[model samples]
Target: MAALTKDSMFERHIEDVEKDIVSVTSGETRPAAGIDSEVANFFASQSQGPIEIDEATDRRLRWMIHKRVLLVMVVTYFAQTLDKGTINFASIMGIVEDTHLVGQQYSWLTTCVYLAILAWEFPTNRLIQRLPIGKYLSFNIAAWGAVLACTAACKNFTGLIIVRTLLGIFECVCQPAFVFLSTMWYRREEQALVIGAFYSMNGFQQCVGGLIAYGVAQIEGQVLKNWQILFTMLGCITFVWGIFVGFWLPDSPIRATCFSPEDRLLMAERVRKNETGIQNKEFKWYQVREALSDPVVWSVTLISFTNGMPTGGLGAFSNLIIKAFGFTTLQTYLLAIAQGAIIMTFLFSAAYLSKRYNQKLLLAIIYTLPNIIGTVVFLTVPTRSDTKVGLLISFYLTMAFGAVSVLNLAVMSNNVAGRTKQVVASSLVFIAWAVGNAVGPQVFRANDAPRYIKAFIAHMVVYALQVVVLFFLRLYLMRLNVLKRRAAALRESTANGEDRDEHLAHNHAFDDLTDRENPDFRYTY
Candidate 1:
């Protein structure tokens, strides 16, 4: 049957059950009217299961969404990555010496950014949920762009930290908004690769930013320093792009003015197979309680933390490590291009393997093992002129840490199913991310600078923790899937074999129910 026509039989059936109490995982039902009205309107509004769309239609529709939705996500992520990595680029461009930074002050610059993110993540998530997420991100993009531009004016540690903190507050919205947008615009099967497409921009920016830094560093006889020019140029570009996104990117299927009314309904219908609701405005606190208590959620959260520490240390120190191995300033910038390539390769590979083989947790461990081995080799290799080549190779291998983030989001986005719960759980994971980042730089103390052997040692241990946590997480999800299967079988026998799937259908699909409350929901590893 066609979806969304009011005159149809499905629309009529929807009217009858619009307010009907529905069964939950606990076998209890309550008056629930908390889903997005766009989704709640007309037929197939709440009651129908997946609409069997043809493969051709699916391909065309996905292409349209990629153009309209995923493109915006990609550029926004790319712009943010450039602005965030500018400080690392600037480390060689004279920001530290010009600003009179000494000892641990440089490390604190990196730490303070994540600390600000850790402090503001929850409130930022709340605003993201309550607002038009696309527009909200646009505003933040412009705000952070302006803040990054102001980094050119900082004359001391205090000034740089203040601006960095503001930049963190604004940019913290990027990841959460994109995670929720993956749910809004794509099917469950498509989310992993779609997320990777945007996320790989970090590596893309690494290449692009390195070349830009190299060109800017060659400027001579200029009043504005090379670092100053770098920040101001990227910052202005980001600010302008934010303005463009505000005008261009559509909010959601319900509010997408770019598509025809018929297309909007079709878009909404397309995502219903997720068995997860499209949009929800109401804040349900009990769902927050559930996310906090769930061990599976915590397992993902821990993996994020473990993965974050190594990334922080490496991101902040890797360029310096490269410079320390007898390379010139220009060579360091040039070498970072290879680092970006390594990052892009790992991210693309992880995304592809997970989507093709349906093995996220296993792939996460695979991605991490190289990072562990790389850190070991990095510490063991002599930091001499002769071993610089070996040292660079080891450092590049450590870039695989960037790939783990794809798996974290793939597992988190596919598993969690409620607005507030998603908000809280993702926030917790990033909070762990922030704490680990904050701590990651501290291990690379100035006393240990040059090789920073302690930092490499710390990362080896952190990578091991990540592998252990991810193994248990995989086991936990497997156990849940088994229990769900057994429960379905038991319920089937009790129903006298009356096509038990008929009873287990997604009756609460649009109720804004948490995954735990939706009996039809299954875990995705």
Candidate 2:
């Protein structure tokens, strides 16, 4: 009789806990009580026999994921960057004379791509949410590859703008896809390193791009200008590469064909601890509101804007600046290889240290400090041959901002939750990026030419301002974490001896809840 009574009490307690966790009222799920049926079903399905992922299995999975996914990401980013950066190389290869570009028309060439991005980002983001990401990205890549090929044939400013606009529309898919896909496959701890490795492709692309352009520059007496030959060759290569992305890349873990059904389940279960759901098709208006209202999103967007000014200025005119320092055209291209190396070193190091030390936000601030020093030197140093070496060193150090950029992207990815909200936040950040890049080139007029003292001063001010913003963003996230922890504590205290399930308390990691709605969703700094 005593044993029966105790068993009845235990069963009753379990039922009460489940009731608290799985509650729904009037077709709407309350954040505090339980997750939606979709999330609850996913957890029940994946939790077959204790979700134990062994170390060896984890290593194997990571290796496969990198081989399958990371390879595509790096190659796609490299091609996109190489194609976009060709304009800088082309400037030295005689595009200025060939196209009859006058005054700010050359600057407008760079601005057109970003302007297109700004115009299309939100609509593209909506498409990303609704469509199969892998297929969508692959199609866009192939489409852009064709546009890039067409760029080789552009004869005038209008022709260039038309193609560059198409390039921007197609290329906008890359970053957001990578961000969402990283969240899909990896844990929060692993995301930074993976994102860093992929984003670092920009640096590698710079190196290879310089080499390719240098090779093209050696050609003479051909029907086409060397710049045209360079574009045509790179565009053809990218077009072929796009086919590979379409066929090989998997969209999400659940949809991945490389793994078995059992392995796929494990893959989905693996990221359940991320407290951000894998994929949610429904676009909730409240989540969109939450994202726009969040201070972190706006702060990150502002940071992107400020940082992008220098990025755009340097990217568009770095070769011109270096040539102004008295290096020959070929010499400028070769020296750019060195700049790429510096970028690669800093970006990889920052990501590694952040992963090793768990200081994502701190490393972002630290990386920007070098850019401040670099800009100050550039502003003060006379544009004379005697001081060229100092200016070159400053230029090299300024590439440290590359690290800051990678960290910022990782920070945004790490903090935001909910598929719709993440998409919205990413769109806004990239929109800011577009605006910054567009504004950056306008600062460097034909009149400013070689030294561009005004441009460097702008960079210096923005770098310093960026540091301040990062500090405040960190403080804001920490405050949110503290508040959430307190709420969690209070909720636990009132449990009345009901057993608290770890997964239940986590509110189902795949539950389509905004970060604000899920009390268990703590902000990662």
Candidate 3:
């Protein structure tokens, strides 16, 4: 016989492989490996063995888990926010006056924190996948808390800079670790609310930190200044919380002590259904590539970058902005408490709506709109005018979108599959945030103190960009949803029909079903 052509031989091999895959997928023939048996065996072995769980017991158990986990997440995140927000609190305590730091040097503290975060986020996220996450996270929290306490003892600008740098290094693990932990515990539908509840710590810190700082500043004849006392108190509280979390928090569903064997299995199965599969044990470069290649990842990056700039500005200098309203230091702190309250309300509302209606993108746009308006008002309204205070209040209140940033995180978690991919997605999302944050504080120059016109303008432009980015992201996601639905329908049709499988097998053709095969999968865009 004449020599077979390469194309002809390749086509024959593809036809054979397709026939096998079609047979396996379509139930046209039993797979020689017995997939059902394997699945059953895998579950039986991995679980602690089955036990019946009544609905009431299941509900109670789940509630306990949620309560425990949420407590840890909320406290950890609250501490994280408090530590980061101390700059704002410190500003009022005469930190600038004491340090005599000026201009860009002042900006460097904020910039260095974010720069540290950007450098460490990816590697830390990856480490979380391999290490004992809860334990690692708790240790990190405690370490940062110790550093935060040291902040209260700083004598000059150099001391403050050193503490802030150390604070950033230890604090880097909390954001991504908390996010990954949430993914482990909650289903996709429940994620936004849980994430929101955890993220409400940001607002809660503002409220509580203001109250506490007011009290701490009153200490008489202390060895430390008021700023030092502020750091000490916050740091001690965080350290205590860290100890509690270290001993108490469960690392994963498989390791949870509160859940019975059957409940654990149910939890696993429930998550599997939502995730499209169980979490992967091993990291893979291909999985990272898959996550990085998604358009949604980039869309979220852009949205986060834009939204983060205003959020970062508010975080770094909210107190300073409020001080411009001619409020006394105590008044500024109290007003911050009110602003924190407004932020909490909006954060919870947005989160609830996003989860209830699956409107992640829409909620983002809605939250961004308020901030955009607030920024415009702050930029245009005369600084000496009373209306400027209202505009400033609006600016703080509109920052409810910071909670939506956590919602964006939940979206990314839901969209990416495999531990490696999750790590990559989390890193990129946080790096975008760090970048925006690093740049934001620079806009608030010392010269622009009472009327930060340039800073307000910068915020206005960024918020507008946020709106635009969110719009495009929503469109991209909508398109992806259409494609996914069409693909799912085709898969269903293929499963149900004989001729289609035969054709597919003979033709050696199949639509990309990787998204379906991977349960923890969705289009990032």
- Best candidate according to TM-score: 1
Worst 10 residues of 2 by lDDT: 491-500
Off by over 4 Å in 1: 1-26, 30-33, 42-50, 490-504
TM-score of each: 0.91, 0.90, 0.84
Model 2 Cα RMSD, Å?
A: 9.5
Ranking by TM-score: 1, 2, 3
In model 2, residue pairs whose N, Cα or C atoms come closer than 3 Å (at least 3 residues apart or on different chains), thus clashing, are: none
Best candidate, lDDT-wise?
Answer: 1
RMSD of each: 9.1, 9.5, 8.2
For all candidates in order, the CA lDDT equals: 0.82, 0.81, 0.70
Q: Residue 431 of candidate 1: its Cα lDDT?
A: 88
Q: Indicate the residue-level lDDT of 224 in model 1.
A: 94
Tens digits of per-residue lDDT, candidate 2, 1-525, equal 999998798567445423322332122355432344544565577545437689998888888888888888888888888888889999989988998899999898889989999999998888887888888988998888889889878889899999989999999888888888888888888888878887787788779889988889999899999988988888888888888888899878877887887877778777777878788777777778768877789988989898887888889989999999988887888899988988899989998998898888899998988898888888888878799988999988888877887888888888888778898999999999999998989899789888898888888788878989999888767655544544444333321222234334454467776666565565777
Clashing pairs in 3: 152-228, 275-519, 275-520, 276-519, 277-519, 296-524, 296-525
Off by over 4 Å in 3: 1-42, 46-58, 276-278, 490-525
Give candidate 3's TM-score.
0.84
